[model samples]
Target: MRRRLLDIIHRFYLDAISRLPPAEFRRTTGLARGLHVGGHCFGPLHPVHNIVVNSIWYAAAFPVRRPAGSDDEDEANALLSTDGIARICHRSLDGLVAALRDLCPSLSNGDALWRLFSTSADLTAAVALANGVSKSINYLSKVLVPSSPHEPSVSPLMLSAQVLDCIASQKQQFKGIGNQVVNVVNMALQQYTQRSGEQLKLHSVCGASLLMEEGLENCYHINFLAYHEGSGSAVGAPVLFFTEAIILSCYETDIRLCVPVDPVTDIGCCFACESNRKMVVHPCYDEYLGGLEFQEDEVDYGSDFPSPLDVDYIFFDADRDSAFANYLWRDSTDH
Candidate 1:
C-alpha cells in the first residue's frame, strides 16, 4: 500500500511538471538536464520528468561513502590494499543504508511519504531544506498549505512564480552593485581632479550599446577605459588624431587601456571596455575664453550601464543567438 501511494504521488508530481507552460517547462527541464549521472545526455524522446525523478532516487539510494576505519587508523593506508579497500567500500555502503533508514523512519507512514514527495516538488520547501527546516513536520505543514483554499495542494506554476521572484530580487541586487561602482568611479575622478589641478570629464555610454542587436539589459557590472587625443599639426595645440595622452583618472581607477584580445570571438570583452569605461576627451586651448575649452560632459545617470558578466555570457549556446531572445520570443508567442 505504501509503495502504491508513493507511485501515485510521483505520478502527480510528474503531471504537474508536464502541465507547466512551454517556456517554464523548458527552463525546468534545462535545470534537470544538468543532472547527468556519468556525463551522458538523455535523448530528445526521454521525458525530463523521468530523468529528474531517477536522478533523485539514485542520489537518495547512494549516499556518500563513509570511512570504515576508526579514529586512530592510518588514513593514508586506508586504500593501500585492494582487499582492504573492498572491505572498507562494502562497509561504507552498508553504513549509508543504515544511516538513511535512521534518517527517514517509518516509510509505511503515508504522511511521511507525502511530505517527502511534496517537499521535493516545492521550491519554497527547497529553500527551507537549505536552512534545515524542511525536516520539521510542523513547518512543512504550514509551508505546503495552498495560498488559495481551492488551489491544488502543489503545482509547478506556483514553483515557477517563486523562481521568478527570486530571480527579480537577484537582478535588483546586481543593479545596485553596478550603480555603486559608477558612483565610486565618479567620486574617484573628482578627487583626482582636485589633487592634480586638471579637470577630467565623465562620459558614460548607454548599456544598450553594449548589448547585441536585440539583447536585454541584464548585465550586473560596468567597465571603464580612457583615451587622450593630442594634436600632430601644432605644438601645445589639441591634436586632430594622435592617441598617447595618459589620462590620470584611468590609471588611478585601474581601467583597461588596451583593446580586447579578439574582437569577433570576444566581442563582449570589447564592449565591456566600450560601455562602462571608455573616455575620449580632447582639451582645446583658445585665446578668446581664457584658453579654457569647456566641453559638455555627456553622462548617462540612468540605470542602463551594461555589465561585463551579462546573462548572455552565463547561458550562452552555439545554436541560439541568445537565451534571453528565445525567452522573449516564447513569451510573446505564448501571450
Candidate 2:
C-alpha cells in the first residue's frame, strides 16, 4: 500500500511538468557535470526523496509498453483515481490534521524540519496548503450539515440551482489573508502534484544519465548497448550493458567461453564475465544483460596487450573489487 501511494504520487508529479512550456521544462531539468543531488541542482534534498522520485520516474519513463501518441501525454495525462484523492484527505479534515499534528508535535524547534523546508520552498508551501485545507474542510463539514425541522425545505434541484447560480454570477474575490489561504489550499491538489512529478523525472534522468554514460564508455560496441543500473541486493555489481535483450540470467558454476570466431557459439556466451560467476544468456534473441565485475589481481600495464582483429578496447580496471585504478590498453595493429 505504501508502495502504491508512492507510485501514484510520483506519476502525479511527473505528468505535471511534462505539460509545461519547453523553456521552463529545460531550465528545471537541465543536466550538468558536478556533484549533484536531484536533477542538476545540488542542495540539502533528502536522499530518500531523491531515490523515491527517481525510481518512480525511471519506471514511468521506461515503461514496458511505450504508449502511442505524443511523447508528453503518453503517461502523464491521467489524474489519480477517486480512491487516491480519498486517501490523501482521509478521515475528517480536522481528524487528519490532528493525527499529523500528534505525530510531529512541534515543527519550529526541529532544526532538521526547518532545514528540509528551507531547502525546498515549494514543498513548504504545499505543506502549508495541506494544513489550510484541513481547517476549511472541517469548518465546512459542520456548517453544511442539515438543520432541524424548522428549517425551510430545500429540494435537491434548488440546492443545485443555488450552487450553479453562485458559481455563474459571483466573481471570486480574493480578499485579504483568509481568501488567499483558501485559494492556495484549493489549488494544492493540482499544483503540488505537478511540481512533484517534474522533480521526480529530473532526478531519475540525472541518475540514469550517470550510469548510462559509464556503460556507454566502457561497454564494447556501439551498435546497440542497453544500460541497466542494478537495484536492491545487486547494487554492488559492476554496471553492465548488453547488445541484446536478456531472457534468462542465473549463476553458472561451470560454463565454457566460446571462441570469438564462432559466431554461433560466441553469441551464446555472456557479454562480460565479471567475478560474480553469474551467467546471462539469450537463447532465442540477441540481447543480454550482465554485470561488469573484475578480478582482484592487478592488471600488469607494463606488458603489452594483445590486439583483437577488429574489436576496440572496451574497458580495463585494476584492483577491481576494492580499489579504483584506470589502465590503458591499445594495440595499433588491433584496431
Candidate 3:
C-alpha cells in the first residue's frame, strides 16, 4: 500500500510538473519552499521533517563508521548524499505546493524556505532516502512469499511501537471534546496524522477512508474535521495519496483476514465542506474509486488519480468555542 501510494504521488507530481512551462518551474519551487517554511503541513511528513527528522533517522540507522580503505565507505557516503534525490523532491513538492496555490490562494504565506528556488543538500538527502525506501519495498514485494490465484501474499507489517505510542497519546489528548462538530473534526485530524509527524493546526485539513467489503463492494466516506467559515480549501490528488501512505504506515501487519476483499482502505484528509460531513457515496466518488481497482473484475488502475481540480470547495463551519480544539486552514495560499 505504501509503495502504491508513493507511485500515485510520484506520478501525479511528475505529471503536474510536466504540464508546467519551463519558465514557471522556478516560481513553483519558490512557492513550495514557502509552504514548507510556513508550516503548511501535509499528513505527517512535513517539508521540515524531510530535512530535520530524516537527518536524525538516517544517522541513527546508518552511522558513518566505515572501515578504513573499504568500498563500503563509498556506498555509505553515497547513501547520505542528496545528489540524485534532488530532482524527485523538487518535482514532488513543486507540484503539490504550486497546485494548492493555484486551487486555493488562501493557504499561501509568501515566505519561501529558500531565497530562491534551489535544493538544499539536507533536503536532497532526505528525499533520496525516501525514494530509495519506496523502491526497495517495491522490489521486496516481488521477491517475497508467493500465493495462489485465490489469495495473495500477506501484506507488510505496520508494527512500529513508536507509531502505536503516538496513537495512544493522541487519543488521550483529544478525549476532552464535548461538541459533535469539534469532536468529529478532532477525530478526523487525528486519523490523518496518525503515523506521520506531529499534527499541524489547520482548519482546511480533513480525512476520508476507503473500505472494501466482501466481493467487490467498497465504501468511501469523507471525514470533515477542519472547519471555518466561507469554503473548504482544495486538495490535489497527490496530497490524497500522500495522506493514505501515512495512514497505511500505521497498521501493525499485513491484513490477510479475507480474500477477494481488501483488508483495509486508505484514510486521508483535505479541505472539504460541512455538507460533505455526512457519509454517502456520490457518483464522482464512485468514479474516483473505480480508478483504484480493488479486485479481478475491478477496473484496471489508470495513470490519473484524484486531482485538486476534481474537488468542490464548500462551506466549512463548526463551534469555535467548543471544548474540543481544532485548527483552521486559512484562506491565504502564500505558504
Candidate 4:
C-alpha cells in the first residue's frame, strides 16, 4: 500500500505539475517542502495517556474524500482528515494573509477566509489533480493497506490532542469573529517597528469546522469515547481504511465533546497501521449537525453519543438562566 500510495502521489504530481504553466509550479513546489517521498510520510506521533481530555477533534465526510470513483472509499465508505479546514487554513494562512493584505485587504473582513480560499484557485486545482490520480491508481492497483503484508492492518489515526486543544481554546476562531482589538492595536504597533512579523491568532482570525451549530448548545471542549451501544459483541467495521481523521465542533455553551474511538487506534491500537494516506472530504462541512444549532439554553456534549438509558446533553459549565436540555444526534444509519 505504501508503494502504491507513493506511486499515486508521484503520478498526481507528475500529471498536475506536468501541465502547470511554470509560475504555478514554483508556488506549489513549497507545499511538498521536506515532505519525504521515500521515507515515512506521517509526522511525528504523540501519545496521550488520559482519554478524558484529548486533543483530537474532527468530523468526516467519506464521499467527498473518496469521490465517486475513488478506491479508498471502496475499502471503506468514509472520508476523513486528521486536521480540519481550520487547521489547513492556518497552515496555508501565509498565502491567505497575502491574499488579504496584498491582494484585497480592503475587502470586508467577513469575506476574508472565503476570498483567500477562492484566490488560491491554483492550489485547489493542484489538490484535485493529485486526488484524481490517487483515485485512479487505487482502482488500478491492489495495494497492501496494512503497514506490512503479513499484518492485518488498522487505519491510521487522524487529528492529535494538541490540535483539538488548540481549537477548543480559540474562542475567536470558533465563530469567525475577528478581533477588533488586535486590528486596532496592530495599527498602532506599525508606527516604530522596522520589520514586524504579522501574527495570527487562530481564533480571532479564522472560522473553523465550517459546519454551523446554530440552535444547539455551543460548548468549547470535546471528547471521544469507545463503546458498543449494546449492538452485541461486534466489530465496528468489517474493514476500515483512511488517511486522516476529522474534527468538527458545533453548538454548545459549555461541554466536553465525546467520540467513539475505533478500537484499533485506541485500546486496540496494537492492530496494524495502514500504509497509504487518503484524501479526506468532510462535506456540508460548514453545516450544523442534526439541524441542532446553539441555543440560549443548557449546553450538552454527552448527547452526541447515545446510551440505552437515555440521550441527554453533557454540560461541563453552564449558567442556570436557561433550563431544559435535550438533543438528538443524527447518525449514519438514521437515514
**For each candidate, what is the lDDT?**
0.35, 0.29, 0.32, 0.26
Top model number, TM-score:
1
Candidate 4, 80-117: lDDT as tens digits = 22233223323334343343344333555445444323
Off by over 4 Å in 4: 1-89, 117-335
TM-score, model 4 to reference: 0.14
Q: lDDT of model 1 at residue 73?
A: 23
List, residue by residue over 281-332, the lDDT tens digit for candidate 1. Answer: 2122111111122232432335555432445433434244434444544554
Clash numbers, per candidate:
6, 5, 27, 45
Where does candidate 2 stray beyond 4 Å?
A: 1-92, 100-202, 205-217, 220-335
lDDT of 3 at 273: 16
- Model 4: lDDT of residue 233: 45
Model 3's lDDT to the true fold? 0.32
Off by over 4 Å in 1: 1-159, 205-309, 312-335
TM-score of the candidate numbered 1?
0.20
Candidate 2, residues 195-251: lDDT per residue as tens digits?
Answer: 444111101100011012225332221111112223422223222222221112222
The superposed Cα distance between candidate 4 and the true structure at residue 218, in angstroms, equals 76
Q: How do these models rank on TM-score, best leading?
A: 1, 3, 2, 4
